[model samples]
Target: MRKMILPPPPLFSALQQPAQHLLPYKTRKKGGGGRESARSSRRPQYCRDPAVHNALYTGDLQKIKSIFKDETTANLIIDSLAEELVWSAELGLWVLAPQKTHTSPLRITVSRGYRDCVKHLLLQGADVDAIVGGKAALHDSCANHRAECTRLLLNYSANPNILSEEGLAPLHLCTTQESLPCAQMLLEYGALVNQNTRDRRASPLHVAAKHGLDDHVKLYLCYGANIGHRNREGETALNSACASADKPEEAGRYYRVVKRLLESGADAQIAGRKNHTPLHNACSNCHIRIVELLLQHGADVNVSNCAGYTPVDCALHAVEDYLEGEPEKLIATLLNHGAAPINPKMLKFCVLSPRTMEVILNTYDRILSCDSWVEFVPSEVWQEHHVFYDSALCLLNQPRALQHLARCAIRKQLGIRCHQGIAQLELPSSLQEYLSLSLEGYLK
Candidate 1:
């Protein structure tokens, strides 16, 4: 994978270096001669003059005009050296290397939103599509959200579909809400909405979904983005959105993104990396609303991922992080939707989450005989909910009451229709609550 390369800082002391030092190192005449010669030959040596560096960095129009008088000078490669900690395969350790980066006057000005300087360079016959340092001027302009510069470059015949060295098109770099206009320009100039990254095969839709960019997602869908396109990991845009819905504060945004994708005909059960469906991802992150949304859209409740874990299993595993999210609601929702009961052996994950444990336990006619879960619960949590813990332990090896058994029988007969069937039963509200495994603070 290509590491992110930061733009070069100001070149105050960089130009003071000796000219010979600025050039690519000469081939070593001794050991590893062929490899050294080939490596040196591929490195482009460019002008490192301080005056041109200042002119481009500061957006000095007249100075830029003087320095770049012709097409060759207009596209002159400016080299900057910086010490980067790079992993050395030979030594098996990280070491500092003086890395030389190359960029052109057009790239510098476009990246900084210096439109006049960019216009001057372009008028001087600067190559708008010239890829120095693995990116064209259009890539920088889009990445930095320089909409005007991006429009100017596209008008000058910059390739909107150009891919960076990292195999990402400019559309893929429109990751923020502010980059919306840049993305619009790319699409207007013939950028492929479904262009996949060379490595991950992730389209701009996947990128936008992963970042929870609802506006970008809306735009892409309108521009004919393939909603079902999967990346190398087999994740569709919906899967990407669910997997990244980790922050509770950001849940609303992700929920909207997922809802929009579903509305656009995204498959809810399409599994991705590790064969995890969007339902699995939503459950694992304890995104209750998204989980409900997915189920409403026909997401399968009992689908298993590559690890043989069902959506309920994923929810159980995430209890620790989402105790405050009312994980019991998610567990109850899954059961109501006909999800298979979680294996008794996996109950340890919910020991600290008494309400979650209660919901899972309520699914069975008889509580499974598992004493190990008690040890996993911290003493503080046990103390906080001693009544529920005590009641649960007392019933571990005992048969549930006849009333509970009847409730279980009704739920079993209803099967996947538990939610709707119970509502239609015309039972009293208290009985309905009991049938739904509503937490009563202690086992009945």
Candidate 2:
């Protein structure tokens, strides 16, 4: 290599001597120690010549090769050549010798879809299963919805079902990215639809349902994916779809799939970690139509989970317009069909009413304070003084008042009864308190 010394600094000769003298005096006064010389060498060197990286950055690879013919320029330009090569490769604009960052030259081409690159790189001996960023290159192509690239890669023996670092396979990646074309291609290429991730034990259907992708869902169903396959938590994909109804577009799609799943005989009663079924999940999200669809398919509405929350409880917890009174309607339907009521908040608050009080107190084994029970009254009802009986009335077990105690709960749950017989009853203070909270929480 020919040696070339960097040119010496040009001088302002008249000020140079004076500046040198001033430097020493200023250093002492300003605390600028001689250690500053070490700092000067710490910064990176910037080569200002545009010709060096310009061709590479701009994808002018032919021009770049010509510049490299001059040995001095090549030596100066080598530092930037790798970046130029990588950028050009990523852009699919030109070919170059493998640079440092990509020493193995796994050429899953960066642009022009996934197909041609797969064919080209396969001929060049690129590894089909080479891992990049903890993902197989097949995942990148599929997730970007590159159908042809995915197909070509698959033909070259890439694993179609390998899980990425995120525990997502090409199927899961396609669902999340909403790439219907790539997902369809994956299925065509023998990708497993019911494949489970160890993390969620969630199948490809579940991933699609969670994100509410309609076409991915349909593709899975068409390919004989078990729509009822539950995750590790025992929740099915339909359950996820019902619970994740965040947007109208998603909600509508979820409903259509739920209808399809039901018609196809997928079970709606499969429970999750807390023993919550699809009905419970729908109620939690306040989807009246979904709740109705679940019930129409013979779902149990009053089934309580391990945490004492029923589909009724979940529905009552929601405040959306269509969701109002859903839990009540479902509960009523189930009750008519012989479902027994569970321990209720009304019973919890009504200690004086002996009818169901014994049963309620027996379940708890101890009285939870009057104040605690009183707190169950909705804030709106409490502010309105709906439950105003004397402290003495609460002291004794009042059995005759049982009919009266049930009134508030009935009214709060079903709305005010207009019948003269119902309006005639004098509800107890405890019962009224129960009514207040139930109504407040429900109305809210």
Candidate 3:
């Protein structure tokens, strides 16, 4: 292949220059030792030899030993070229251009989990802290979840807190459950447990919570991670956990993370971006268990976010996306926890979600004059759930039965304490279920 050498970007250009130019005169004048160290730290020259590339890519230990016999050879930047389609403004058409990339032997081996090759390179005096291709060998090891290589790099005195070109520390890249060991190793080697990314200001704890890595969160907490540390968006780890619990299959894992955060004294009502509390986030994702957990931890059920949306309102908006998650359970939980009855006009939001509509309707003592809900529901959905719809419409603008009236009266008297108060009453289990608005598939 033809060789294509492009000028490095400004960041790499700065890395290639001697450090003395950027330092104070007194520091620069220290000695030849400082000057030599600076020279050694400069970016290494690129190598386009196919023999060296093959030795590094295949992890050929003897071939690597023969080729990288010294520090300079081991640290030489390896160049790789590829063809990518680029839009040409002059030609007004797409054309193929040669794209050049750079990496070092240590980074290549470390990312591939070649422990033997990595040790050999490090033993040959490779710069453990060198930033090649915008990342150090340690970053590659952690990002690829190569625990053995990570341990080897750290043992060779690699800077555990080194940031990538994106300003993310090794801990920030430990986003998967499989990377938990790498994260633990980082923390044990004096990685800052609460280190924040340069751009987002999201700490390690926030990263763990956002991915629903409960064990990672537990480990970070044990290492004294700041659970309440807010990102640039002002979101605590708890808020991130709730907001990211969007997948129904992953809801349980996120629920556990949220529970751990709340148990660790996370402020349940703490608002984040857009003045949205964790409760608002949990409800908006239709995480019933998380919503209930937040409520039990004293999350304000009636709190409104920047958009003037209560938790119930957020839950209503989420009904369509989370119908399979039993969004009605979230609505019921919010109402039981003292959320004000949703505005009658907002009932349109849950019209398609029959169960959700039923829960909201059960909160009222008397059915109001609202026929527009019939029009909001799709014709096919209305036919599918005509039984529930017919029962609800029959009771519109009419007084409820004596049993429902009594249930509503008891629920109102208990107000926010409805759950505990009903449990305390000497009523039968059936009566308790009724008072709690347990659905019988239709309103009575």
Best by lDDT: 1
Encode model 3's per-residue lDDT on 263-313: one tens digit a residue: 999999999999999999988898889988888888999888998999888
Better of 2 and 3 by lDDT: 3
Q: What TM-score does each of the candidates earn?
A: 0.88, 0.54, 0.89
Worst 10 residues of 1 by lDDT: 26-35
Error of 3 at 114 (Å): 0.3
Model 1 misses residue 172 by how many Å?
1.2
Candidates in order have lDDT scores of 0.86, 0.54, 0.84
Clashing pairs in 1: none
Per-residue lDDT of 37 in model 1: 32
lDDT for model 1 comes to: 0.86
Q: lDDT score of model 3?
A: 0.84
**Candidate 1 per-residue lDDT over residues 23-95, each given as its tens digit:** 3322223332221333243333367777878889899998988878866577567877766676777888777
Runs in model 2 lying further than 4 Å from the true structure: 1-119, 176-178, 320-444
Q: What is the lDDT of residue 186 in candidate 2?
A: 80
**Per-residue lDDT for 1-444 in model 2, tens only?**
122223222211221011111111000112221122222111122232445334433445455455444322222211221322222435655433422221111222422353443354455444455444356667777667776777777766667887776787878777554488788878887899888886989998888888877777778889998877888888888788877874544567788878777887878888887888888888776666777788777787668899887775665455333333333443333333323443445443333222223323322212334553554545564445433323222533433245434543464344322122233458665643443322221110
Worst lDDT window (10 residues) for model 3?
22-31
Q: Which of the predicted structures, 1 or 3, would earn the higher TM-score when compared with the native?
A: 3
